[model samples]
Target: MSILLSVILPVFLVIGIGFLAAKRNAISPAGIDGIMRFSQGFAIPVLLFQAIANLDLREFDLRLVGTFYTGSFTCFLIGMLAAVYLFKREWEDAVAIGFIALFSNSLLLGLPITERAFGADATQANFAIIAVHSPFCYAVGITAMEIAKAHGHPPHTIPAKVLRAIFSNSLILGITAGLIVNLTGLPIPTVVDEGLSMLVRAALPSALFGLGGVIARYRIEGDLPTILFTLSLSLLLHPTLAWGLGTAMRLPDEAFRSVVVTAAMAPGANAYLFAAMYGRATRVAASCVLLGTALSILTAAAWLALLS
Candidate 1:
């Protein structure tokens, strides 16, 4: 418990300070753009590439994959529905809420913590699910948003627009490219490998710090209820759901424990960053992020203890 809390506390403190800073008109979103871009474009890809590359594809199980996907998909769908419905908003607004609500920060926060608590196997399980997550966010997640955004506009070509969004997404393209490299089993040149390694090294800390910078600029005054609601879904509801789903699926103990805790432990999905980037309810998303991140330390610690 102490070990888990020790890791989470500092991470969120930076996030909290970031939030307070944001509220105070320090480190505005524009100020953090470079940090955000570098982390998203360069660093996160390195982290994700190494993760997927290290995965033993032979160990990939369709049944296990099905079970994991079932859990993720269900949670995402349900959470989003709840959020949108609760907000008394339009379907597009609901779609945005659903996208963020359904997905946790499985990549940045979940992966590393799972690695620490459970080992590579647990981390990889989440990674496999997350590989699915990355694609889904690009395809299904964004399409929902784009469709919502376009509904009021004059009738236009839907398929072309959808394709454009998918093809143009750097994260989607990066993951697809990385997976292709991993699946092909080609030997990477040392120089290329080193180059990738350097980028990956920068990805983790830079992203963390960038997240800190974003938080530094967050405003949380009127959004407290939304913050609490999202936290309940993330730190509490999501874990409970994962626990129930893991049991029904008959997952192994480590896998079961890891996913249950990880689903709960992960910070708000960086998709919140997307919300702000596009200027969609940025304050709401930012506030949820700041609060969710701040509470994660205690909540995660409490969760670790309960699991033990």
Candidate 2:
């Protein structure tokens, strides 16, 4: 209970504040965009970089990463198949649904929640997962979208394109730099470390507020059944799959807890962005983000209690 009050409650309170501000027009969409950009481009990268730079790379567990990612991939495939066959969705739309189901908001929501609930080790685990997550999820999504749109004739330069996409991402750049620092055992200058710490302090609250702002802007305008189905997959099945796979693989308690909390995260804003860009099932994707984030208060609390 103290954990919930100290950590989780504060997070939601900030989110609620953002939601009310947006609803009352106290902040413009531009303000929300700025908040998100600052959080993602600067604050979070610094935070992640600092964490990764300090980690013992040799002791990092690739097995835990493999297990969590594999479970996400499995869920993606299953969601895509279900969307196509059961929901009668077009291939492109189905792909969007699949991406929404698989890509948890591991950075924005997962970082604060896991760090608060499980402390520094869990934060380290969360950073490790975030390092490769976007690239993997985006790679799968790009391929599916290309195939669906191009009728099986995707660009011949896919590998180059994927490589560029992955490297161009700010989050990946942070992870890469951190990996370099860790592998080489380079010392961070005291000045640089102090600067990063200052910037990192802004990440969590800004991210939570930005999350609420995003959700507040999302308008649900889709078939109820499809929206509900994807919501179920995102909020329920994804976490269940992560827990099952993590336990089945006999991951350490901390690692397993990390996986479960990450899996329980709301649908990422990236999913909604991808859907809007593809112009397929945009409503469903946006609804997933909005509803998933709103409802996650309860689900996250339950998971935290169980973990405790």
Candidate 3:
């Protein structure tokens, strides 16, 4: 109960503050660029480096990694395909919806949340998620962007053009750096670790606040039916799929719940930006992300306690 309250309450309070502030017209998305750089370049890289550097890979479950990522990959593909079938919009928009529904902010909010939710013993599983987050985003996510471009404006130089589409992505870069250091058997000195910690401390608030700021500027356009239809897949479908798979794999209830419930979390790993940059329904994606993120705090925390 204490763990649930401790984890859920702070996040709720932040959202509450954000809701109030948005009502007051104080929020703006202009500072978003700066927040993006800070979180992507410095804060995220440091957090990943520290997490990866501290990890003793031998302590991790090899099968768990395979299971989790396999589940993630499957979920991602299915979401994409489902969006294609369901959306009356273009296929490119469908692709964007798919990625956002399946992927998450594994490095940013994921690491800290998993640590707080599951403690040190679960850290390695959390790291496994972090490790996959960037690579998956780059590989699958960039491909989705290309689909968008092919559907819209075509850039010069095939590969370079494709690379440019995803080049500005910092989360992908940061996770890659962390993986390199982790794989290289490098030792991070105490001073470097301390610096890393300081940077990581800002990741959650900046991102959540940035999201809140972005949402404050507009009202949702759809009626209840449209909103529920779009969001239900993210809130219900992916998590249920993950949960079914996790249980079949014999993951303990808590672990099963963690991975499954978090899958339903806001499509965190840069999907909204991808949608906006790619000229899909930008407002729709943004709206989905905001609502999904706010809803996830309750959904996830409840799942954690229930499973525990």
Best by TM-score: 2
lDDT by residue (tens digit), candidate 3, 25-92? 56544565566567667676666666676667665555555555665666566656666665465677
lDDT of 2 by residue, 272-307 (tens): 987987898888898888888878888888887887
The best-first sequence of candidates by lDDT reads 2, 1, 3
Q: For each candidate, C-alpha RMSD in Å?
A: 3.3, 1.8, 3.5
Per-candidate TM-scores read 0.83, 0.94, 0.82
Give Cα distance to truth, residue 221, candidate 1, Å.
3.7
Poorest lDDT segment (10 consecutive residues) of candidate 2:
151-160
Writing each residue's lDDT as its tens digit, candidate 1 over 174-263 gives 667667778898677899889888988777566766677776655676646555665576678778777777777788776666676667
Select the stronger candidate by lDDT from 2 and 3. Answer: 2
TM match of model 1 to true structure: 0.83
- Candidate 1 clashes between residue pairs 3 or more apart in a chain or in different chains: 18-215, 18-216, 19-215, 22-216, 22-217, 22-218, 43-203, 80-98
lDDT of 3 at 64: 56
Write out the backbone clash pairs for model 3: none
